[model samples]
Structures are given as C-alpha cells and as structure tokens.
Target: MQSTEQLDEIWQDRAIESIINFVRSADGDFNCIEKLANAVSDPDSLQKIVEFLSSTSQGKQAFQKRPLLGNIDLQKLHRLPTNSLGYSFANHLLTNNLQPLQRKSVENDYEFFAAHITETHDLWHIVTGCDTNILGEIQLEAFYVAQLYASRFWLALITKNLLKTVIYDIELSTTYMDAIAKGWVMAKQAKPLFGIEWNLLWETPLEDVRNSLNIILPSS
Candidate 1:
C-alpha cells in the first residue's frame, strides 16, 4: 500500500500539471479535475462532510449504499415526465454530448467524499441552471467555493480566468464577475446538497426540487 504522503504528493503533482494543461486548452480534463479534487481534499473536511451527511436519514442510507449516480440510465431519464429534473438533466447531457462521470477509485473515507462530490457535480449544475460553458464553469466553481470552502484549485482557476478575461475584454470581465457574484449569492441561499440522493428525485418536478432545495437559478 502506498503511504498517505506518497498519495498526496502524486495527486498534487498531477493536479499542477493538469491545471496548466487545462488552462492552455480550455477543455475539460477529467483526470486533472479528479487530481485537483483529491489534492485539496483533507481528512478533516472529509470527516465533517461525511458527518453532515450522516446526520440525515437519507444521508445515512446513502453512505451505506454508496449509490453511483453515473450508473443512472440516461435513456430512462429522457423518458421521464416533462419538466422533471431527471428529464431536464438528461436533455442537457444529450444536448451537450456530456457523458456521465466515471467512478474514481476511493481508498478511504476521505477519498470517498471527494469521489461522491465529483460524481454528483453535474447534477448540481442542472439544478442550479449553470451551463457547461466556460463562464458557466467559473460561476459554478464560485458556487462550490461558497458552499465548500476548500478548493484551492477553483480559486486559482477563478483568478487566472478572471485575469485572462480582463486582458481579452474589459466588458467580459465584468460579466464574469457578475456571474460569480450571482453564484455566491445563490449558494448562500441554497440548501446543502452534500448528501442528496439525486436518483430518488428524478421523478420530482424540476420546479419542486428547486423550491425544496432553495435553489435559485441564474438569470438567462
């Protein structure tokens, strides 16, 4: 077995290289994303988040079952009732040609926490109405930063992207900041999504799910 220090170093090294590559291309990098998540994911944060999840009845069951969201059938979701969260999410994925996230190897409770967050990431985007565009990504990251406070990777990305935008177009930089502000505010008002069993809510009306979760979508 690898020592914890060795694993941390591996993630950190991979994360730095991946971030650099991602910045150069502006394309999504799954491996890099996972590495970044694991790099900053400390044991304390994991335990606290897990404990929060365990506080709820659904959360306790979620930890025990460890349902993988990626296993959800998009075809079935596409056939769900109109205006259903799952239907909308399925449509979003199909329209964007985005695939479900693959499960990452989880060696411990901390790693499981990071993996769970990564797996449910797109579901958060759907409920929040954030697009898959670059600006949308920054906004969503801002939201995550507000809700989860431990992502140095997001902060770095936000800073670098903001600088890039400022140099490319002053007006666009303003727009990006607006998106970030909205994300922060929306996250502040939203219910914690940490342990939500999204599979159970697929049939729920999209509006109802948003209302229940206190989710405020961004203005188009």
Candidate 2:
C-alpha cells in the first residue's frame, strides 16, 4: 500500500496540460503565466535551476543574499526623476493600473524565484523598453529564453504562446517571430538581469541603468 506522501513523491505531473490550456485561452492573462510556471515547478527542477544560476557570478551574488523586491510605494517611486527607473516603473504601473504585487512567503528556492521575478517583471518591461502588449510580452519571454535566467519556466510559456500564434493567429505570425528574434539577439548584448539590484538603481537615470546592464534596446 502506497502512503499519500509516497504516492506524491512518485507521481509527477507534466506541464503539457497547463501549457496547452494557456495557449488556447490565455488572452493576455498574466495569471496564466503564473499558473503555467507553477504547474512545472518541483523541488528537483528548482534545485537544478538554482544550481545553474549559482554558476554565474551575477547569479551567485543574487543568491548569496537572495534579494526580494517585494512591493514599493508607487507614489514614492513617482517622485523620482522622470528619467529614472523608479519613475518610469511607477508610471508604467499607474498607466496600466497594476499593483506592485508584493512578495509571497518564500521558504525555498522556487518560492524565492517566483516572488522576485514577479516583483521585478514590470521593471523588466521598463528597462527593455517593451510595452505592455502581446508583442512586447512575447519579446521579453523570448529574451528570458535566450538568457535562460528564468530557467525552463520561460521555455514553457514561449512554447505555448508561439504555438498559439502559428496555430490560430496566422496574420501576426511573422511579426511574432521577428519579435522573438530581436529579443534573442538582445540577450547577447546585455548582462545578467537576475543579480541586478534594480531597487537601488531607482533614482539612477533609466538610460544609465540600461547602459550599466549593457542593454541594447530595439528601435522604436
């Protein structure tokens, strides 16, 4: 007779179902991305990911302290210089009407990854100069794929979204691929975003932050 814990240990769920569902009906829901990530996550997988991150100097620094941005007061961020990362991020949130989506209790590597990534997600858009649109989101995922900084979690998201584009939305297919290519290219030109202390750079000029990270934005 298998104990409940024994069964849980032996039984592993595949990410296919979640990926397919997100593809078919995500319609730009961020929660779908969240759910998809959660679907494929387990201790062993997260440990591998953490191990990979630990290999890089930036990732090593990031993990040594395991920085978590949590939430910030948007109003305070808005007070920063207009050309600063903080102001731009605050403006982005205000324009999109999104909360900072504070950190959850992170007791393990997976939780820490999810919490920090979620907290910094919009900040990536700001620095990358990607808009809050389908194309922009796809590009960022593609960037994440190239960097592998987010691990296989992004691979699953990009795979589903790319399939969705090709299988159903044929008209935008070319543009989608172009965006992905540009994002992939963008990765080669930048430093690791994982270990960046973005919160500390809030008052720094946005361009300076980008330059420090060696970010090469695609033309508008």
Candidate 3:
C-alpha cells in the first residue's frame, strides 16, 4: 500500500499542475476565473461577500432578491438608443460572440456572487473601459480585491496572475502592474457597484449610469 505521505505528495502535484495549466491558458477565458474562485472558495470569503452585498440598500436588495439578468433578450437591448447602457452591453456581447451567463439558483452567497459577476463581467468591461484581455481581467480582479479584501478568491486570483506575469511573462510586468494600480485607485474613488439593479439602468445613457454610480475612470 502507498504511504500516506506519498498520497499527499501526489495530490499536491496534481493541484499544482492544475493551477499552472489554469494560469497558462487563462487569457480571455471566463471559465478560468470561475474555476479559480471555486478552487479557493472558503466560508470566510462567502461571509465577506454576503456582508459586502448587504452593506448598501441596493446590495441588500440584491442579496435578498437574487436578481437574474441573463435571460433578457439581446435584441431588445440592441434596439435601445446607441448611448444607452443596454445598447452598449448588447453590442459588446454580440461583437465578441459572448453569451450572458445563466444562473439556475442561488443557494448561497458565493453562488449568487459568482452567477451575478459572470453575467455582468462584460458589462463591467464596457463600463470601466477595460478591454477583453489578460491585463484588463487582472485589473478587474484587483478591483474586486480592493472592494472585497476578505475574499480569498479575489486575492488568489490576483496573486496567481501577478506571479504568472512576473515569472513567465516578465515583459508584461510593468503594464500589468499599471493595470492593477489603476483598478485599485478607481475602486477607491468609485461608489460601491455590487448588487446594483442594472436592468433598471439599461435604458439610461451609459455615461449617466456611470455618473450616478460615481464611477471615476483612471486618467490616461
């Protein structure tokens, strides 16, 4: 029979391999973010997310209502005024060939968070001017960390990408660092965006929505 130590080492090796593979192929892949979150999920982080989602009236309602937006018709959004948030979001998805993420249920805080974030990830990119690229993705994760400091998933997600860039893609280190810095500062300056009723704001002008949300973009 294999020794317990040997079994432990084997498990560790598998875990490390999985992480490496994930980091290597994570670029522009939403699944990687979801996978990383799942891998590092803990009860502490879930509680922190719940608290973060409950601190504001909108967030409180979000937590209670668990609003799902993935089922909305893209054509309706597409027909909105070009300056509308819905139009921008729909265009972003259609141009990129991305589909809204479906959420079946929210049995827990983490599930609610994951589903909501997934559905709104592209919307965030549109609002924040983050491109659908590796740097933008990392920057977004850093923004999440700034807002949800207690979330191990966000922290781990940021750490892995930073390490990957530092060790394997040193040429990207400076730009990635800049992205992280920008995201952190932007989050600090902006009002909380979690648990927002985006459906209500879909018809609002994109800039109007951002202004109401007190979003401050990083300077060029």
Better of 2 and 3 by lDDT: 2
- The TM-scores of all predictions, comma-separated, are 0.77, 0.88, 0.85
Candidate 1 structure quality by residue, lDDT tens digits, 1-220: 9998998788678756755654554446666555555555556565766776677776677677676665778899999998998998888888889787757466665556667777788888888888778788888888877776555656766765776665555778877898899888999999877668788899999999999989988677
Model 2 per-residue lDDT tens digits across residues 1-220: 9997875655344467777778887577778767777777766667877887778998887776778775688999999889999999999999888888677567766677667777888988888887778889888988877765446777777688779878888888888888888888888788878767788888999999899889999885
Instruction: Record all residue pairs in model 1 with backbone atoms less than 3 Å apart, i.e. clashing.
Output: none
In the range 110-173, model 3's lDDT, one tens digit per residue, is 6788888777777777777777787787778778777665767666667778778777888988
Worst 10 residues of 2 by lDDT: 7-16
* Candidates ranked, most accurate by TM-score first: 2, 3, 1
Name the weakest run of 10 consecutive residues (lDDT summed) in model 3. 11-20
Top-TM-score structure, candidate number: 2
TM-score of 1: 0.77
Go through the candidates in order and give each one's C-alpha lDDT. 0.75, 0.79, 0.77
Cα error, candidate 1, residue 104 (Å): 7.9
- What global local distance difference test value does model 2 have? 0.79
Clashing pairs in 3: none
lDDT score of residue 130 within candidate 1? 82
